[model samples]
Target: MTDSTAFDWRSFLLKWSGEWADSLPESETRDADDEAARQARWLGFPPASEERIAAMEERLGRQLPPSYREFLKVSDGWRNAGGFVWLLAGTGDARWHNNESGLADMYAEHLDEDSGPEERREADLWRRGLQLDVESDVTYVLMDPEDVDDDGEWAVYTWSSWRAEPPERHANFLAFMRDMHREFHSLGARQGDTGPVFANDTTRELDARVEEARLAALGGGWEQAEKALDEAKGYSRPRAAGLGDQIRRLLGKTYMVYFEDLVTDPRYTPELLPPLVAEHARHTNWDDATLRFQLRGADDELMSLAFETLDQVRNGTYRYTPAGPFGEAVDRARELARWGGSDAAWRTLMDALPLWEPLGPDHLAPLAWVADPVLGQLLTPERGRELLSTPRAGRTGTPPSPAANLDPGGLAWLAEPDRGNNRTSYRFVLVEGVHPEELPGRLTDAGGDGGGGMNGDADVHGADTVLNAPMTLWDARHTSTADQREFSSYDDRALVAVGRAGTDWSFAFDDRPAPFHRPRFVSPAAAAGVGTRAMVVWSGLRPGHRKPFFHLSMAEDGAERYAFTYEGGEIRRSGEIPEALEPTRFFGDLAEGAAAEAERPLLEAVTREFGASLPRHALTSGRLHTFTTRSWTRPPGQGETYTVVRRDPPPAQWTTGGHP
Candidate 1:
């Protein structure tokens, strides 16, 4: 979980010793130095008696692996003393299956090629040392496994560890495992098939090899093994050595089948599992666009397979959480639901996603992708034009799209209407939810779908109530304004007139009100119902200012002010401040010469601090002001307002609330 926790495969192997044959006892009678003898000793594959077989099946509540049935007859060559290996049969040629590799053909090529057994023994020892030399921390060296050919000649397994020509085998194996893991991973990725579904070609070949091995046992090549398997397991417990001999000879014929399956058809995908797939299945049909977003893959390589997996969930191949952000995997599925594949694949993927989390606004963007009006803000301006348009953009920037960004654009929306004395003033409100209520707003690359605070400020106004009509907000830092001392601007600010884009931004200037638009703006959520949270970053609180003050409170009956804080109850604001409002840029200190002496008139200090923020000073009531309003809303059509917190003396403060 920390820097100290980087993984070590060696440590993992050491810890997992139980999963290997390390616990098995060695046979002292055989030459420990002999490779053939040592392999025979360890590979005591024997058939279970009938009673034991039944008991094992009953215990596991499943059929025993068929590979164990063929190791019983006496003729099966199992011990090192025996000249033949029953598993390989005579000449080691796997019937119908290509065994033209390794020892199978080598032994046949020149049975007398090596004169003495000592030479063979030494060579085997050398190889064994390479696989388990604890002193050197050395594991098996990568080498090609030798096999037999149809013509009974020796050949090397193309990608066997002993031979390393094919580097692509690892990837192929990984793909196979990933897909197979979907099927039989006990955790329940697959339930109905009772087997594995490997994707990679290597695993497919591996599966074939295993079956070939099993078929060998049935073909009488390992007669002893078949006889051993036919005996009742419980009755033959004491004769294990004899039974094991038969089984060992048949192992090459049978066990290989099971081993190959383990590597090839591993259970990895949820389609092989259950219950979880059941939940995700809903996304496959795609009634809920939010769910579709969670099924798409990061890369396209797995899209087709992923889509197929989704179909399995829909078609009953497997079952799992159909949709959710519950666990890491499920959460990812939720994301893919919107971005999984090509149009058609997406439908399949969407339908396959199971529901793991509750449906709400925060999930809509990923669900709808650019279709989500709010998150569309994340696209680069060029991308935004491309994604938010109807026809999309052409290569030459010619009519990129016929549509506009329609989702939540991070502007703090009003949850309710304003109650005002003048009946003409405006108000602001906040969305009612667990998320914090906002005051300041900005346009940024992050959280455009209303997840976090808006990136910039609400200063792009097109004069009085017509807050910058085009409503285009760019997320930049390091900007200044007329009341530069009062508030810091974005690194850069972009302004555009309402309903007008393309080089027409007369209102793109200093101190413009951004939220006071005359024409009502609709949120993307309103359009799609499901959506994400939008965090607004719009506030210029002078440092050390105490809040909870009703002057800017929306609850008060100042009509417009009353209309604004409709849901202020839920809007999270800094509890209180001791000093006046200072933008975050100043931190806890005032600019040079601004603090001045306490004896200096507070108005002058205010002037130095706020510059030209207000027309009047000294907190005088003589400055009658009109309160403006803004709104905040979530998806599925709901809204309210908040009384704009501004100074009556012109360039006053508008503190949208959230902690710095």
Candidate 2:
């Protein structure tokens, strides 16, 4: 069965039209008026009959992607819609050649080999493609049928008619639509022609209110949390409709945190289990760790109830009254327990088992009466700790990577390795698969630092064979390397390292190989065997250069070389001739001037969301050098190299770049 959370094309079209219309001002321009008339016409058109869609597909010799088909079933054509997306044809308008506003006809115009030089060159590449839109004379978006993925979705690209460069890619039609929608709304909002997208003062206020509720819920102040959540619902903004869900999740946290208080209260008894369990079921998505710790304090009866609820959920017999959390909880609990079977379930639970509170013998006597075997096993504090210490190895039977358990202080693991390759050499190798072989080279070119070629004649060692040792083997490696002699003079050349454990890989750097050491690193994935990439930033003051330089890179080997210094709200980034770092759209061009606090929030928000607490670089200007390695790998049991680089600035680039 398709998960309930699966994207619904029909719902999206409805919401898109409804929200777009709602946001538009009542007074319409000629364009808006024309669009409204087209909308009215399309709205009155019957949903695409299956027969019509089939006939259209037969004539076009291609099947429309599911999203487009769904759009057809709602409206025959997108008129005055899709923001800057221009037009999307429905069945009757989807014919070939010169037929009406048909999609094929639009694309066919771009395939003319007899056109002028510029037009012919522009049309050649898109001859057999699906033209999505032509927003400007220079820009045309198209879906290349030849570049379809495993899922049968074509890769969409923005073709710049005059640029000799390759077309910039988007993942698919749906993704391209989403990006265009956001881009249009963002630009429109900036120009004062539109209000904030899906959020305004009311939504922000509601979010703040929910954050307050979340805090209260965490502190066991259930009443206060519930009240704040209620207040949030009074705001009639479209986004506030989810306030009730927020309240339910808070209530779930309340149950977990104050389980003991509720269990012993005169108003409740063992019968309260169903509702309590169900309430928590609604919050299956919550990642609050405090609840996990508090759950250990639960009494025997409460523990038994939780286990019972878990069992019922796993067995498919659990039912929630009034359609509460049962559905979500069942799926969530199965996911948490890695529900291969009872054993896997038990082990999964144990991985998160907390230390039980100290209790008198009288209180402990009742634990024997508990019927859930897993619960009883967990009650023995030592046993629970032991079980948690060594979770069941995954399908590969490899223990969870030590890198997964790194603390924030262990940031040293992300430092550039001392490439002064001595025994202190943290020289690790990149095992090809973690990133496409072309990545390091491409980044090097983009940064415009041929590294070895940067200083005209300096021969630099690229970071191709860098590999990191896991914490388990760190002590041994450290002790063995303690006696290594330091090089007479450290090379000015920058060193780049890739850290890995199990299937996880990340960019890491260390100033020099230090024998006595502890290392810390963060995997961008933050999960065991699932994270595909990581990033690292390292810098120092150069001896003769007299300026501080930092190198920033992802799992991709090339690093952005820059010298940064903050002047009030502006960060002056200078070094590489081509400007290595892309200007962040969030704050515009920093050099153009901004309040110092403007970029702080963006960085802080990223840190909160992704734990990317990289060291901030304050320019002190320098010669830039970008280095990369063509070879790298650690021994097999040592660590697994990632094949993709985790894109910077969080989600937007990463999502469009096709890295999960």
Per-candidate local distance difference test: 0.24, 0.37
Q: How high is each candidate's TM-score? A: 0.19, 0.30
Which parts of model 1 have CA positions greater than 4 angstroms off? 1-428, 431-537, 540-558, 562-660
| lDDT score at residue 201, model 1, on the 0-100 scale | 34
Error of 1 at 609 (Å): 27
Candidate maximizing lDDT: 2
Candidate 2 structure quality by residue, lDDT tens digits, 145-196:
6666666666676655466665667777667665655454444333344443
Output the lDDT of residue 291, model 2: 31
State the displacement of the C-alpha of residue 643, model 2, in Å, after optimal TM-score superposition: 51
Where in model 2 is the C-alpha error above 4 Å?
1-7, 32-46, 80-83, 92-125, 134-138, 160-168, 193-417, 420-660
Best prediction by TM-score = 2
lDDT of 1 by residue, 39-65 (tens): 433322233456654654464344322
Worst 10 residues of 1 by lDDT: 616-625
Once model 1 is optimally superposed onto the true structure by TM-score, how far is the C-alpha of residue 591 displaced, in angstroms?
5.7
